[model samples]
Target: MKDYTIHRGVDYRVYESEPTTFYAKCTQYGAGCDWLIRVTKMSRKFCWEIRKYNGSHTCTRATISQDHSKLDSNTVAEAIKPLVEVDPSIRVKSVIAKVQAKFNYTISYRKAWLAKQKAVESIFSGDDLVPNIRVLHRVFWSYYPCIRAFRHCKPIVQVDGTHLYGKYKGCLLVAVSQDGNNNIVLIAFAIVEGETSEAWHFFLSNLRQHVVTRDGVGLISDRHDSIRAAIARSNGAWSPPRAFHMFCIRHIESNFLRKFKAPYLQKLIVNIGYSRTVREYETRYQRLRERVEANTNWLDRILREQYALAFDGGYRWGYMTTNLVECINSVLKGARNLPVTALVKATFYRLNELFTRKRAEAEARINAGHVFSELVTSKLHANQRAAGNIQVSCFD
Candidate 1:
């Protein structure tokens, strides 16, 4: 085996290599050493069998060096696949250390770096990305292009966070939006130590300062205490006229379920949040009031305008949950396994790719003389057709 040869620090020149047969002889075979191996596929068993093998090498290795010809980048990449999968941003120095520990050979930094690159390419490329739902929040940042792109998206933004995995434990915070066509747009993101007030303050401050700079934007998120504290401390940055912070109805439902452990009553609470008119909301609240008197106080504590659609004016834009941002979280399932450096790189790279591709599509549509997105244009045609069917009454 190649591994055997590398471990033994011996050199072999291959004589034959095939699908079912392999033969090699030691480099010093004719001069002194008689080390050789020959293997052939057994017809009946369909397994390679050693037809001939010299006992052992009778001469010293071809040369004494820290590096081995047998241990190339491909071999090292295969060996470090597990490590890279665990933490793609693992340090090159750490890779060298891992190699030295595993093989008793010191590899150069360049070689280790190359192996890591190869491993990352193989893991993150094509259809092999992290394929589950995980979220994190530690800091908040938006690329200049993404920040600029947000200006054209809907006036609402959704934010969320999730836990990080692997050697370093933290949280990833994200803010996302959607275009008229319902494409999820990642606007800002960051990693933080946890969902603490200080962490949120840092992330939100940067988010407002750099990315979400416009006024009258709707900021949707879960009703986490730290987020509340961060908004309260924002001195109107996240307040009325500047911005409006709303709660994700899904989070409210989860909270309701967790607190009362009443699965049956969850629908009533959600109905209260989803009520589209004051009359409908009052009817829903009355229904819930009849069942949950003691448990309803927490519901009343949060302003209806902040969560209930009927009271939100038009700020909610019919979005009832933080699902858009949570969507960004779901795409990050495997990224949490990376180290800070690698995690950051992978996150932005993929998001940037998404942003770039979408931008090109939008530009292409505009060049083709389209003012509204396909979804909006279709809605306009439908509304116009419906209006044509209406009988208008003249006002006195």
Candidate 2:
């Protein structure tokens, strides 16, 4: 028999046998002990079993062992310490290499790079912490100082939405500026789930809040009915501060041409687009309007209304046309398929690259004692000279 304490100040007499089981008699501590213990073992060591001692002498049992062991929290913490200490950049590269190996036949390096970036992004993404669209928009806006510089200028805000594809497929509305130098600058960007009147209205409302502008700002955009509806909804507060709203001449011409479907009338409409004065525009407009009236009276009325509104003196921005929005759309081409944050980051990077190139070109021109516009004009003139006998007109 081996004596041992089984509970607080309660002593037990333990008995061991060949089967490696121990039996114990409980002794009283404070409460009377009416329990007996049986210890059992199978392979390595003896184990204790406790049971209520019914006078019938049948045993009830619970198992306990002294040699049981498990890895402690400290051991686990130490084992994982090295993995935590490993440089994340190195880990990322290793994971990237493995992914590239697995998909080597299907995807390109650029796509692989984007995938790796997405994976890194996912580690920080979770249900509780999604990326913020506003933060992305701010990152985009920060790249263009020209945008901030002209924030108060009564800018002609042009907006057009285009579909994008990615983790979150949606549409993007881009706000742009035609600065004093005739250069187009991106002002802001937003991504929405769809191109609904409500979405456009919401986007415009947000733009109204973030874009600080002086009174009398002008807005130019395509004649999408949803856009018109959005502008109408914004009549009181988000309305363009100015008394002018301009429609894209190209969009209007396209609309007019669609109804007529006449090659001669299309040529005539193009002439109106290239015309210098209102008198010239009126002459061309009258000619097309008559042909249009002869063909379809209803179509003629619509064309005249749209043409009059678009060509009205207040809407014209210097040249006979304005399509800087098309330039913006082109710049956003490659990035339209990215996630919202990626779209914003890519937009800022691309814009910065564009302006950096432009700045370099401008500095080169200055060093050579020639202005950028002059250099472009001189190049155009040289090209025109080489194409002798052809008349060239400088529209602006």
Candidate 3:
């Protein structure tokens, strides 16, 4: 009806309605024009019925305006911004339907698509300035409360990368750390073509120079060739005496399982990785070597200290896995399907929600006189109970 009004230089209004029927009459009825339309709903589907028409209007031309539609790209973008933000996969037809329903104006599918594009750009780029996105590489980076939060967070940082899905092909590289409450805190992110050594170097070089400025920070990640080469090419930026590097023990076990085809070695390898003392690690590792002599060289090739928490000299702080960073990947599962700019904006919105919710929860907990987070308090109690049962020996 809105589309007809805009195109035909006439207006319409609801005349009457029954349970299954709707009647709309043309606004030229005062001039004795009988142009009208009727629709009947049957079993939930609607069918149109042109009830009466005189073909030619008897009304004077002074009352009607033969103007184009008032709905433009900006109007459509503003109308659908909330809908698109909620679900990036929203269909173009849905946008058309929404605009027709809200503003009584039907837009073309092309207009809806263009509106979505404009809205996405408006979201990623602020109203004041457009986003500083590079066209050549299609790379973007974001640092939120991460910069301030990292100053107080532990020095242990985890790095990981996952592939993106959309019209453009790329990978999302992420840096994550844990706050005092053991919450996963995202530090930075980058989108690149793939996990090449050059890409890793670019990500790491920026991370070192801009993101993580603290010296002797610990870095944990999978032993991807690109990551290894990038760290090696860092010219001691990520090397010892400044920043220590370690491999995720879970990734190492995955490789061992894939190559050895021995499910039994899984628990044994995990035990060795989690061992707190060299004696225990040696015992478990020797058993593994004896059971799998043919594949012992594969295990020996990787630096034990990188995967074994017992050999890491407490640098890992009991976290031998990259699960924290993987959690961030899981949180961003939906955003990965969006375009590069939308993906970045989605992360920004998600991080904003996370920070706000956590800050409110922290304040509430503090008001309740809690000195530590619930997890930490519970751990303290459990350790205290265990300490009371220990038998201390004064004589050596």
Q: Tens digits of per-residue lDDT for model 1 on 83-200?
A: 8866665778988998888878899889997888777777665344467835554445678777887898888988888888865788988888888888887888888999999998
Q: Is candidate 1 or candidate 3 better by TM-score?
A: 3
lDDT, candidate 2, at 108 = 36
* Residue 57 accuracy (lDDT) in model 1: 81
Off by over 4 Å in 3: 1-79, 86-134, 138-140, 366-396
Ranking by lDDT: 1, 3, 2
Candidate 3, residue 339: the lDDT equals 72
- State the RMSD for candidate 2: 19.8
Q: Model 2: which residue pairs collide?
A: 21-39, 22-39, 216-241, 216-242, 217-242
User: Each model's TM-score, in the order given?
Assistant: 0.64, 0.53, 0.67
Predict model 2's lDDT versus the native.
Answer: 0.54
Q: Please count the clashing residue pairs in each candidate, in the order shown.
A: 12, 5, 0
Model-by-model lDDT, in order? 0.83, 0.54, 0.80
| Best-fitting candidate, scored by lDDT | 1
- Expressed as tens digits, the lDDT of each residue in 252-339 for candidate 2 is 6677667656655655665665666678867776776676566434334443323344345444454333466667777677556555
Off by over 4 Å in 2: 1-147, 151-154, 236-243, 273-276, 294-311, 319-322, 352-396
